[model samples]
Target: MADFNPGRDEVEDVAAMKREGDLSRFLRQQIRDGQARRDKPTAAPKPAPPPGYRPGAWPSGTSPPGPLPDRGADWDRALDRYRNGEGSDRDPCHCGACDTPDNNQTEEN
Candidate 1:
């Protein structure tokens, strides 16, 4: 078995390697390689966002598709109540979509 001595200062050699050698470059290259292997960009990419997630999917950029279907009458009424502050004091539908079809930028015939 090889004898090891702690007082001889093995860390000095490591410090020398870190400073003069390409050890840092070698370590960075290894890390980049490992990441490339893990990522494997050549593999299939994730599916694009759904129709609802697309840009301008709704009148408001922030509005998400609601649990309520696009029943225009109910949407209008809800929007009216929300505008008048007749609904909950919290203003739940203030996101501008009214959780249904848009009341903004619409005309009733």
Candidate 2:
């Protein structure tokens, strides 16, 4: 009868390697590799922004879109009423567009 070897064809099990202290050695090697990677300098730092660079500023020579169309007299009156404490929740909006009737209503014959 042949002598029985615990390892099959010279391949040792993980538990056997741990008992033999190889696990700690491998772990230390991995830790050293990680530390070396972190200590290595990264690529060149990003260039600093130009002097007086204002974040969120529109680029030079570009202006915001033209001012909104004037709100006109009706809007002014509404705003004035509100400021003078004459406006109330029940007051109808005078936006003009809403004052027009929808297509569903027809003039009575």
Q: Which candidate leads the pack in TM-score?
A: 2
lDDT of 2 by residue, 1-109 (tens): 6785656734565576688979888769979998988866679988998876788997777878998888798899888876543433333453332333432235557
Which parts of model 1 have CA positions greater than 4 angstroms off? 1-16, 41-109
Model 2: lDDT to the true structure = 0.65
Against the unseen true structure, what C-alpha lDDT does each candidate score? Answer: 0.65, 0.65
TM-score of each: 0.23, 0.28
Q: Show pairs that collide, candidate 1.
A: none
- Candidate 2: pairs in clash: none
Residue-level lDDT for 70 in candidate 1:
63
Model 1 steric clash total:
0
Instruction: Please write out the lDDT profile of model 1 over residues 1-109, one tens digit for every residue.
Output: 6786645465676576688986788679979998888945486787897656646456545667569676999989988876755544343565443544343335569
